[model samples]
Every structure is written in C-alpha cells, then in structure tokens.
Target: MKRAEVLVALGLLVVALVVLSQAIHLGPGWGEDGPRAGFFPFWLAVVLGVSSLWVLVQALRAPGGAGARPFFPVGGRRLVLTVFLPMAGAIALLEVVGFYIASLIYLVIYIRLTGRQGWPLTLAVGVLFPLITFFIFERWFLILLPKGLFGERLLPF
Candidate 1:
C-alpha cells in the first residue's frame, strides 16, 4: 500500500511538473499587472508538484509504506475508486452536462456513495450545494462555469 501510494504521488508529481513546464512556456503578460493565461496554472502546478513530492517523501519514510504492503488492501480499492472515479466523472461531465448539472450530479453521487445516508439528506445537499455555488460564482462573482446541455440559455447569469 505504501509503495503504491508513493508511486501514485510520484506520478502526480511528474504530471504537475509537466503542467508547470507547459505553463511556464507561455509567458506571463508584461507591464503593470503581470498575469497571463498560464500564470495561475503555472503556480498551481508548482504548488501541486511540491506538495506531491512532500507526500511522496513522507510515504517513503513511513513504516509499512507502499512497497511493504499489498498493492490493494481490504477496502482500499473501494475507497480509491469511490473518490477518484467520481472526480474523473465530474471532469468528463463538465463538457457534456456543463457545470451546474455536473456539479449537482457529483454532489449527489458523492453523498449517496460515500455518506450512505438517506435519500432526503442526499437530495437536499446535492440540490442546495450547486444552487448556492451557482449563485455565489455566477451571480456574485460574475464568473461562468462550464455549460453542458443546460446552459446560459436556460439559466442565464
């Protein structure tokens, strides 16, 4: 388990480094406010890379690290899939369903899958969280999230 954890962290570190490199290639805007398209991405990639490396280091030093344990322990696979699969689905859903629907679906799925709670609670949170986020980001901040089938036409900001 520890070994796999370290490997995954290392992989994330590598990916972040790649993203950082790509971002750095895109020069930031010059003069006055110096933020370009890649400014945030590049910095975020740096932070992610550093953090991933730190975690990798800790895992390497820890007892029963990834190399010492089974690749998938009892309940490990379920835990990993439950967390990662939904996150991947959320990203994929962004293009197809857009942000609101995709986020709502993700919230609902997360509640249902992880919480093991009742339908009422799951539905309430799933519905409310996205609505609140929609209002906060779209209405308040004047920012737009991805739109899928249901988009600006139906729910214009």
Candidate 2:
C-alpha cells in the first residue's frame, strides 16, 4: 500500500507539473478585466501537486515503504475501475449532454454510488459545482461553454 501510494503520488506530481508547465504558456496571472486563460488550470495543477506531495510524504514515512510490495493490493484494481469507469462515462456524456449537465450527473453518480454519500452532500456537490462553474466562467468571464441537447431548452444560461 505504501509503495502504491508513493507511485500514485509521483504520477500525480508529474501530471500536475506537466499541467502547470502548459498552463504557464496559457497565462496564469490575472488580466486587466479578470483572470488570465490559464489561471484556474494553473491553480488546479498547483493543488494537485501539493496533494500529491503530501501523499508522497505519507508514503515515504510508512514503515518499509521501499520494501518489495505488490503495486496493487487484492481489491485495488476493482477500486480503480470503480472510479475510472464513471469518469469515462462522464467524458462520453460530456459531448452528448454538455459540460454542466454531464458533470452534474457524473458527480451525482460518483458522490452517491461510489462515495456512498448521503443525499445532502451528494446533491450539494452535484448541483453547486455546475452552478458555481457557470457563474464563474460563463457570467463572470463571459466565456460560453458547450450547449448540448438539453442546454437550449432547459437551461436559461
């Protein structure tokens, strides 16, 4: 578990670094009117990097972390798949349903089915995210996102 944790953290660190590198080109600073193109993504990368670093630290601190241990525990593959498959489905749904709705559905499934969270937390996460994202990106930044099948009729934004 420790070894696996370290490897996963390292992988996330690499990804975060790569994202941060690309985001720098996109511009991470604030512009005259609002945030630059890369502002959010860059910060996201930073958070990912920080969290990964923390996981790496924990893994390294664990006893015999460097010792031989199978990368995946017995049920690790199932856990990975459980999380991954929904994300894959969400990605597919994004094109058909657009970002907000697709993400909401994905969050609902992930929070409720996978996380086994209560309705309050599930609904809060599922609903608030899209609403906040819409306001932040669409209203504040005046950036238009994809309007899929249900977007035109159902959504006012």
Candidate 3:
C-alpha cells in the first residue's frame, strides 16, 4: 500500500511537472484580454505537484514502510472492477454514441446493478440526468457537447 501510494504520487508529480513546463511555454500570466492560455493549467499543475509531493513524503514516512502491506484487502479487486469496468465501458462508448447517451446508459446500469435501486428511480435518473445535462450545456451555457458519429441526427438538437 505504501509503495503504491509513493509510486502514484511520484507519477502524478511527473505529470504535474510536465504540465507546468508546458504551461510556462504557453505563458502562465495574464494578458490584456484577461488570463493567458496557460493560467489555469499553471496553477492546477502547481497544486497537483505540491499535493503529490506531500503524499509522497507521507507515504515514505508511513509506519509500515513501502511494500509492508497489501495494496488491496480481500475482495477489493472485485469491488473495484465492479465500478471501474462500467465506467471504462462508458468512456469507450462516448465517441460512438456521444456523451449524453453514454452517460445515460452508464448511469442506468451503475445505479441499477451496483446500487440495487428500483426500476422507477433508476429509469428516472438515467433519462432525466442526460436531458438536464443537455439543456444545461447545450442551451443555457451554449457549449457544444459531442453528439456522436451521427451528431445532430442522433438528438436533433
């Protein structure tokens, strides 16, 4: 567990550093128009780097030390896969069916199977959630979301 934590922290730190470098190249300061392209990324990378560093330090100083404990308890892998596999499938479906449809499918399956909720509640959430998200992002915010391979033909929006 300690080893895993340390490794993950280090990996995140590396990613943070890479982003920070890119942010610097892209100009992390504010311009006349407002914040530069890299402003938000720069701060986000800094925060990630600092947080990861803290985690790495804590992991190194942990009582049991690296590799002294199991990364996951009994049945942990199964538990993790139950959630992860579905989400991964959703991501894979995104490009094919679009965000709204993929999310609706994912939410329905996740809520129904993992949460063991009644059909009414699951169906309500599955359908309404995507519709609400569509309105919020497409109409209110005027931000275009992916509409899949069929695009507007799929939703007519």
Which prediction has the highest TM-score against the true structure? 3
lDDT of 1 by residue, 68-106 (tens): 668777888889998898899898987787888888888
- Where model 1 places Cα greater than 4 Å from the true spot, the runs are 1-67, 71-73, 153-157
Candidate 1 TM-score, true structure as reference: 0.54
Candidate 2, residue 44: the lDDT equals 100
Which residue ranges in model 2 land beyond 4 Å of their true spot? 1-71
RMSD in angstroms, candidate 3?
A: 6.2
| Model 2: lDDT to the true structure | 0.89
* lDDT by residue (tens digit), candidate 3, 1-157: 8778989999999999999999999999998899999999999999999999999999999887454768888789899999889989988888788999889989999999999999999999999999999899989999988877754577775
lDDT of 1: 0.84
Q: Give the candidates in order of lDDT, highest first.
A: 3, 2, 1
What TM-score would you give candidate 2 relative to the actual structure? 0.53
| TM-score-based ranking | 3, 1, 2
- The candidate with the higher TM-score, 1 or 3, is 3
Inter-residue clash pairs, candidate 2: none
